[model samples]
Target: MSPTMTEQIVLTAREARDVPHGEKGKFYERASERLGISTATLRRGIRSAAPSKERRRRSDSGRYALSREEALLISATILHAQTRDGKRIKTLKDAVRMLREKGAILAARIDKDTGEILGDLSDGAIARAMRGYHAHPDQILAPDPVTELRSNHPNHVWQVDASVCRLWYLEDGLQAIKRDAHYKNKPKNLERADRFKVTRYVVTDHYSGWVYARYVRGAESGENLCAVLIDAMQNRGDRDILRGVPEILMMDKGSANTAGMTKNLCQALDIRVFPHEKGNPRANGQVENGNNLVETTFESDLRFYTVRDLSHLNKLARMWRIRFNAERLHSRHGRTRSMAWLDIRQEELTNAPSAAACRNLATSTTVKRIVSSVLRVRLGGREYDVSQVPGVLVKGPLDVAYDAWGDEHIKVVRTGKDGRPVHYMAPLAKRGAGGFFEGAALIGEEYKRKKDTPAQTARAEIEEMITGERTKRGAEKARKEKRLPFGGTIDPFRGMSEKDARPYQVPTGRDHPAIAPTVESPRLTPTRLAMLLRDRLGRDWPEDGYQRIVARYPDGAPEESIPEVMAAVTGKKATPDLRVVKA
Candidate 1:
């Protein structure tokens, strides 16, 4: 029996290894001709091949076809041909041609027995295999590895995530209410706050792409997250058809999500918390996908609406949501998100938490703080004076329970193991008013502000003027009396003239010229001279002394010494070039 081409190459290389160094090249050349293989192939197999390769018979199959090992080598070579940093690397096509060099056999061959092609791997095939290996992990090791998630109904699982929005909103609305602390009057502070983008808390239905959202000023707190959740669950109208307490609140391990208070609140409401591992948000891909929708579609629509404040942003977002859930079609079902949600809602038994169940429940949020020497504790944005509590010894940090929604004032106290209220954590009185009964009113105002028409806004301004302002005369007095950003009045009159003291007012008529005393006349004597001063002193005088002007005037009756008194003590001036003397 005769050895096949691959067998002959193996045998030749084995024998060539024993040949003298000077005769190795000539032997390889002779072997290439006899075996119908390239000298380079013979040289490579000789250098890199193992000594124990199996032989093939002339009558056996795979006579002209490349082996699995050969195929892999060719694929690697093709992959190496890809460009590196714009430098010319070998091309895959050129690399493949090297396999078919002159006198070299191709990987595939037509069998003479059945006229069938065996092990037919093309250059294109090799290139594809190579690129796939380098580009993806496990493509070669374990191909098509995926675990598809199955959500049978809406709210079966809700994925929640927070992403900073891409664009800044106009700060004019947020700036309407000034913040004394945090970004106070800093240069570009408002711009920076807006440019940095507000955080958007998104809740997405896993079964449907239905989404709910809230945009806030800073990082999400535990209470804020719960509050946002409440909004998502509360069904405002038929348009808000996606409302329901999710069976599972899937989220990342953010401080807001992981806080004990947040867990307690959800547990009380019978909502399961499914937090992903610290770094993996893809676990809750529903919300992540929602983020993409926001970036592409919602944000694109925002170009038309003004983002002045949270209310405005939320209003626009709500309208966009309606369109997104009802009008826009989903790729998976060829139906809208709202349609999908309604379809699932038909069969699913939803257990949405009631308003009564959630009210005042956010008070579980607790923090520890040490009382300063001033007998006060600072919580949220307000300070409480414990000084009135009288004769309390110095103490370290105290556990304080506060309103998570900021809808109530904080009470300094310790909580039981179950997070129930215990005794007073610290002896202190509630210092100031917080988000209480009027919180709803404030929210309504914000909503109105956002949706206000030109007429409504003007009317609101007029009402504000009526309520926050005084009578014209009183307003004048109030404007002159300087106060603070918060309260209390003092004479801020130091740096201002009388006109400047009343900045909001514009002068008219005689008041247009300042009420300051002029050189022609100073203060009225308050005696009988008051009539004389009030009646005749305003006339403009000449550049010379007042005596020249007074002398040219007619004298009063002999009974009245007022004219002589005025001539003796006062000046009447009618001067264009005259200047007022300082009083």
Candidate 2:
């Protein structure tokens, strides 16, 4: 048992005075330790006439102490103490390793941002210093060297991740919204309702802090995560604006990120994907901080009944995205994502071209084809209509080909009669695969499929035979065959089965008229005859309506200044009705 501190202090004071003058203070400390009185208390008690109020106060002050030489020995002890291998520091001695080092020690605090020392004190109470306090021989702590590595350009690097939403559903019999409102002294109906448990992937521009959130089924699979990421990048007009891919992709080493498919996809895209170190999630502090806010901000209201229905949950996540990017202020930027994104690149935005720069891009006109009034279209908008087929089912995969301006043309390729290439309008619904094809630029298979088919080969052969009819041989044969089949004793039809009942007739040579009959000819309008004359005379097409002019000369007409020809043709004026109308 420890003795009364007052008794111990008086004994130490008495011993100090009795000892030789050279050893007075040392002797007093030794005697105080033997008597269980603190050296500080002994010194103060001896300073006054009686060991009273002042003695008690001083004793309390010197509960933890060591002399100058003793401090150096303790510092050496701290420097060499064997710490428990994996255990974290909990006490002052454990923190500074005071049990192993014996040297003069001082208390210190280092800056969080810059590692420089904020304060230091050389004291004999080194082993008894507070937990956060540190002892160093130098005047201050060292500065961190990594602050100079910040990025300088916009879109230089973007951090992407999937995280849970921060919205919650509380199922208290008294509706959560109403309960909150009631507690706040407002009407129950005044509180806003919320949904919970939707998983979303958040992307943040490292430099600008611009964020985009997309609700996904889950981030458990590499395919789902990759699909969401690709969609977001394309939608933001990244390919149009940057014209290149990101240099680095930072992610954690989850199964989704480290899977073989993910590795192959990243390699194909030429992106360097890096994983954070194990046990140090703070390595991705920017994204981790965003996640912390997501989880912590709505912790009180979150309630997950079951993981079945994610529709309402997904809707709430989408709403939070608008709030997070458009309304919430970031500590680093001191502004919302919209404001910061513009402010960061204001120079480039101001200097870029206006209307004249956009002339190089192409545009398209859209047309519609109505069938059964149902109006089913596979395409996105009501545009692009100049070449639409009304009632034919198009075959093959739909392709979305874009010009420089992002104008889309839905096209399909088919073989022609000559076994050559032909292009046709592709069905709209089949064109883009709902924008999934755009990601193909960044992450699709590398090979293009060949378009030849067996049907095309058969058609090619038939067309070749039709074109190569021998002129000499076929003409002579046709002349010989023109003779009456019964007189010439030749069969009237060729390649007919003997059992057929129908008989064919061959034309009688020399009996056929030298010129074809004219009475049976389809009647040609005066306008048609005049058009033929104008074309034969090398005149441009007339702009006037021919139907109106034909009303005056319905039968025939003579060319102006061709009077002799008109008389030879039995006409009064050029028009057939000139006699009746003129009279």
Q: Quick one: best TM-score, which candidate?
A: 1
lDDT tens digits by residue: candidate 1, 505-564: 666746456586754434323233433343455552223424442444333222234454
Worst 10 residues of 1 by lDDT: 572-581
Candidate 2's TM-score reads 0.32
Separately for all candidates shown, the number of backbone clashes (residues 3 or more apart, or on different chains) is 6, 32
Candidate 1 Cα misplacement greater than 4 A, ranges: 1-144, 173-191, 194-196, 344-347, 351-359, 365-583
lDDT (10s digit) by residue, model 2, range 1-583: 2346655566655655568868877787676687666777667766653343433455546433333444444434444442656332344455344533433443454565997867643433454442213333221223333432244655556666677443433333212233544344553333433232245666666666655555654335676566544544453342123212344566788888776555544443334666766655555666666566555543233354332344554455455555666777878768776565554454433121122222211122222333222222344553332124322232422233222223344433334587632345533332266654221343464754323233444545543354332354653454466644224446666767777867679777676557875554344456655555344334333444254336546675543323322333333344333221112
Q: What is the lDDT of residue 242 in candidate 1?
A: 74
The list of candidate 2 runs beyond 4 A from truth reads 1-149, 162-200, 215-219, 236-245, 296-308, 342-583
Error of 1 at 265 (Å): 2.1
- CA RMSD, predictions in order: 27.5, 33.8
Q: Considering every candidate listed, which one attains the maximal lDDT?
A: 1
